[model samples]
Target: MNNSLLIKYGLAGVGLDIVSSADICKHVFHTKASTKRMHTKNDNNNTEYSAVQSEPWSCTERCFPKLICCTYIHKTIANAFHPFIFIPGDGGSQVEAKINKTNSVHYICAKTSTDFFNIWLNLELLVPVVIDCWIDNIKLRYDNVTRRTSNTEGVETRIPGFGSTEPVEWLDPSHASTGAYFTDIGRLLYFTDIVNALVKLGHVRNQTLKGAPFDFRKAPNENQDYFVKLKQLVEETYESNGKTSVILLAHSMGGPMSQYFLNLQKQNWKDKYIKCLVTLSGAWGGSVKAVKVFAIGDDLGSYMLNGKVMKLEQITNPSLAWLMPSRNYWKMDEVLVQTDTKNYTLSNIEDYFMDVEYPNGWEMYQDTLPHSLNLTAPGVEVHCIYGTNVSTVEQVFYKAGSFYENPTLINGDGDGTVNRRSLEGCKTWSSKQKQKVYDLALPKVDHMGILKNVNVLEYISNLVNGL
Candidate 1:
């Protein structure tokens, strides 16, 4: 980052106030500030190939899973917004990103580390040594990590659709007509104890959420095979009935993933089957969780011990293995640098994105991802479902997975993640749809609860039947 770039970005205006669970290597650098990279001499060339640092005892990276996972999801989902522009937020930290449920016009904004160039530039080659190091830290994924793990894995239990060496026979008789259950998201298959319990809900007013079958092993990148699989599923299902009748029920990250699929369809480049698309707690718009993560590193144990993570205890129960803790954009030595706090030890949590703001038109919807799909594909029964239950998470995080900000934006309704206005477009969208965003609100459901809530399911089922 050059001085001119720094001046242009105005990164110093923001504050770094939050948690961190960066990798052990990062933590060593943070706590000791004296740890050096440890590289071994190449046996053949007898030359030091590179620097591989030896980290001491730091456990932040080894444990914080949800933060890292969600971080990747944020990037994967944010990628869906690249076809449009994202405007910068009030703080200039995040360029608001949004997703349009109709036409699927996505808006995205990306700005790299604001502090690295200031401190890590080598000064001679005009090259960013520190930024390069930070890049090396996170660039691991785009460069080799994604490639390295495409086939090899050591997962404890593989979900149904995704690759898994271990056999999971939950569904004795697979729904040949409907296709496999969504075991990829939730380890439990549809035939297993969970989905059955949930289906029982439709019969006896029972409440059972078997969890998502789509396991986000790595947030499905637009170019990944998973995207192709999703597209294929949409096509097969839509054409299965010989037409688009079934609804696409997606939650959280799935919402954006599905949106990306539809966006591809809009370009006349996608060949996925589909019909109605429903988003539940869909992070069509970015989540406040990302903002909070960047502000605070994921030191959950520390936060839990200190009682700070309790702030989110309600919104995101037990911040699983998707949260990455590299959200801070500090200003150092005139360059803007973004470094993943990493685990307290030297472990690298997954979700690591660089600090380069790809001018891929990612600045239009600063807070919203892409919000044009509804207008693009008006034929699709585009419905937005949100949970209205407020938890300690939303009470502090501003927006968990619900929309609760800018009351003037939508009318003051939120699904713990999305606020009322954030659901669709401005006033015009509302006049056309009325309270269709909520249809009917579930008083006390949390973010995930919307997917499992009986009321929400009924609402979805009814909507599907109408379609």
Candidate 2:
């Protein structure tokens, strides 16, 4: 086999010197060999070498070429525990795109490509001039007749490793060089810490722990296939783990998505398959942030980036419309956006969209509004964990000439991303359902910080261990 192929298989680091000659002989010649560690010293440089006893196994020349020995790495068998399914929020999953476009928006943009490349979290595409290309490639197109969205013409996209944690834990499998430099900026950008914590707590990845990352650009209404697969995955995981119920761990929009999934299932199915639902920084009732996202776009908390650059793509996503401020939480007269001549509230959202010159946004918003309007109880035990005490955008103000440009933000109590009312909306489930609802509000923890916060991690560990 080629050395580069071995490296790609993650075996290049394994030293052949560690395998004993006796083990290789036993595998090759079918001779019974006694396992023993051998120590030797090279005559030229007087270099000492120690060889570990390797397990005898079948080997072929095509498999290892010159190497005839292989080592078996032992793995610990975890005890029975509640399986976990991590559902990521919007833009939390890694998305790979293949370009097959017949037309190009820019001369530099590729019209066709043979390989799929990471479109999201690949910072290389997020740079100044290239970001436009990335936006065009990742943007979705809504069909008025279907009332559903599809990828930009000629671009095919897929979420990799649907039933594994690796894709969600490290969005860009390559971890692009930029991510290394900005790793400390946001923990929610990746779930590495959370996955590591679960692994340390005796949860084996892919067996006891899995991930459900979908096309975050679309809302749950358009995710029927995803829901079907998620149901099968949950049942398969439960049966594989000695019929142990699963803990649905969700973050941000995943919280609502999980709830929607649960609502679709039968009560007995939830009672049997679901251990409990644990949501971190759940946007239960939507957020005022979505209003701003519609008004003038958002950098998604990145201050250095221009929000307008991504507005075209962000506005096209139906999921963002589903995350708009819900009437169930926001009052009718309460203003979410204020301009020189008019103030916009939840009741006047269509007018807000009309004034912004994106009437199509109102269509998308109306299509997705009914899905999250009721916020029905999922009929499962719930643990809602969220952050508070940080200032979040509650409202936006625009000057006369600057309707879609620079806007002033009015801050309110939240987790720096979601409003407090929305974060605490899960509390409404307490009296609505038979299952017990536990709400945890951690002070001074921002939205992404909740993922890696020491206290939050400890709490999750304790909860999983106890279950």
Candidate 3:
């Protein structure tokens, strides 16, 4: 697409240059030498304490070379506050890809590697022709025998700043393309508002506050390494904070991933290390939107973009399969996808995949479905905060001979992305676990909007303060 077309599509003033992820990382993770000390009164205790603002803490060079895993921390006299770890949702983390493919899908695609560059949130790569290259590099390949997914051959991908908030806060650190132009249309700032709110509350980044941004392409089953790292981060954060329990703040797919992680641990481990679980717009049960994304492409709510172009890459992601409307939440008889010949429900999702001509989706679904099917409680205090009163996709209708073509979407109540049933699926945990489950329904808040919603932020602040 041309500059004019991009401008018309809400990607105003298209910049032709590609910014390297290394440059953005350096700029975002750079540390300053300035330090200042100020006295402040604690609101809760009415006691005066010295607060020192210094350079952010980072992992040792031995652990993460050439990468700044820094977290902003404010040194205070009292260190009794609860530390937090943020887990990001789908497409919420920045992914870097180094091209070394033996074969090329198109001449325009990158096949040789100079260095790693940001593939996700790199607007320059998402342009019409270049996106083909991106699709190839970002797509995953599933192994039927191993029942797992791997990156495209010769394409090495990694999540930058695994233990820091920088990757999840602003996807594009340069803030040039999508951040500068498409903010009104799509999400550029992921967990920025929440991080800022926590900072304001004197929760230090990387010290008292940290982020766990995993490779969102694969489901939890395929992300054992990430979960292991997450466990260490939580434990380390807890130990660093005087053995204080860590609070897990998760969003969307992160919620389910966190739940799975919690389920894997012993009750004693959870009781000793975890404070509570707070999920914002949690897909406690998966969303119906995934089914539609499988059938027809999702423009990510941007009408100007062609969703069909990215369909193949999206379908290859096992995480998308994991996000399909959960059998635990959706009734067997409830129709999720409608066709001229038949309607599909939770019981016949495999047929829906076969009809869509991507039978591999069934294998992926089977591999991931077990992770969330039980919906077991995390055995800790839970706070499920999600949006409501927004029209969400409930069912999709495909006309005769139009399975891959445009389909009609039937809307139902949700957060404009997840259905009400999925959002409320956390309610099931209330009765299953001994720990308290708190539910907060914010009206008129959309999925991404919940991250920056004033009410939601205020609620989080209060919750953190009270804790």
Candidate 4:
């Protein structure tokens, strides 16, 4: 085999993992470094191809020359053998569909359809929706409140819907349903920049099947078709590329989903399919925001004025709750919360969401938040990257004696969304294994910014080279 084809790369992205616009690729790829292309002699002719070279490993001739040489050879061979697979986080992959006046759904895959610039370029149109969502949420809170004469018992305060505001207005002018058109910013821009960088580095290849990105809205295990198709794609990549093992890049919710997928595989699958698992801002432990949304809802429009007005309601979405900090990994019960008149603690905050008993055994699955702790794939090298430094709200307070109304926030350090402690979810796996699990907490990096951060990309590139 030629030196150029030595290593293969597979990249997975975060939630709503939709294919990005070519323009984004073009813009981001050129912003930093260009793709490294080299000429190689093929059987028939000279061809220009992608190439990647690992940084050199040095040895002093005076001491341990043989040892150094062996290490160098092993490192080069290792670098050339593995491919990367990036599993996008929640909302990273999504399908763009359009509905006609007659109600038939048509999927669109054009350049304009994937382009976020067109959708968000008009700040005027977008900003108002955000403001409206924020105002609507505030009103939702006030409207839902049931005033008390003396904080009477047995009277529950009404909970306002909060969290993510769905941009129903942003949908394709033709489609009226929420899921009918994929309108999430996360899916459009999440992996495009990283993909461009990886492709530019060369030697890395995307082995994904067309139109097969996992649906961020659905539970990971529920997507049997996606997983089955992914297995076929993996086999195809390996068969076509001399049986290269995969380096999985899982971000945000993708981290847990990757674990879920790996856990389901045969015990020996890691040896044949995986090389290293690197997670960027993995939400292994669920986020506090998800719990807040589950318990009382949130107005995300107030925080993010990006053209979409999203008021996350106090509703149950098992997938969102799955992002909550794992009970096995965190002492969530010990965490303290306060109210204007009373102080309370959460023994198991996740209990707030799973209160309703489902008819089937499905309640069993949702009730157990940390089932992932047992799903670790043995022998897989693990590396974790997460953002920190932003003030994170670790707990929420309510009006004294009010169970679900008048919530207040307390702060700690984290990305704007996931807190530092939750981002450190990978550490929960340390006690369970002897293998070294690595992590890096970057200052001033927000959850979304990690994607565009040049330093992060370089770090990942180095890791890929080392592999």
Cα TM-score per model: 0.38, 0.82, 0.82, 0.60
Stretches of candidate 3 exceeding 4 Å from the true structure: 1-78, 177-186
* Candidate 1 displacement at residue 414 in angstroms: 4.4
lDDT (0 to 1) per candidate: 0.30, 0.78, 0.78, 0.50
| Best-first order by lDDT | 3, 2, 4, 1
| lDDT of candidate 2 over 1-467, digit per residue (tens) | 11222222233223432322233333433322334434465543432324434343355432454332332211011124688999988878988999988887778777888899888778777777778788889998888888888888899998889999987787678754443344323622467677777765546688788999998888888888999999999999888766778999998989999999999999999999999999999998888888888766777556556778778788989988898888888898899988888989887888998988877788889898888796789999999999999999998988897876779999999998889999998999888999999999999999888888998889888897676
RMSD of each: 27.4, 9.4, 12.8, 14.3
Decreasing TM-score order of the candidates: 3, 2, 4, 1
TM-score of 1: 0.38
Assess candidate 2 and give its TM-score to the true structure: 0.82
TM-score, cand. 3 vs. native:
0.82
What ranges in model 4 sit over 4 Å off?
1-81, 97-187, 204-212, 295-316, 335-378, 400-406, 434-436
What is the per-residue lDDT of model 4 for residues 139-195, given as tens digits with 9 covering 90 to 100? 111111221011112112221111111121121222233221223233235565565
Error of 1 at 297 (Å): 5.4
State the local distance difference test value for candidate 2.
Answer: 0.78
| lDDT tens digits, residue span 165-200, model 1 | 111112222212212222122222222221222222
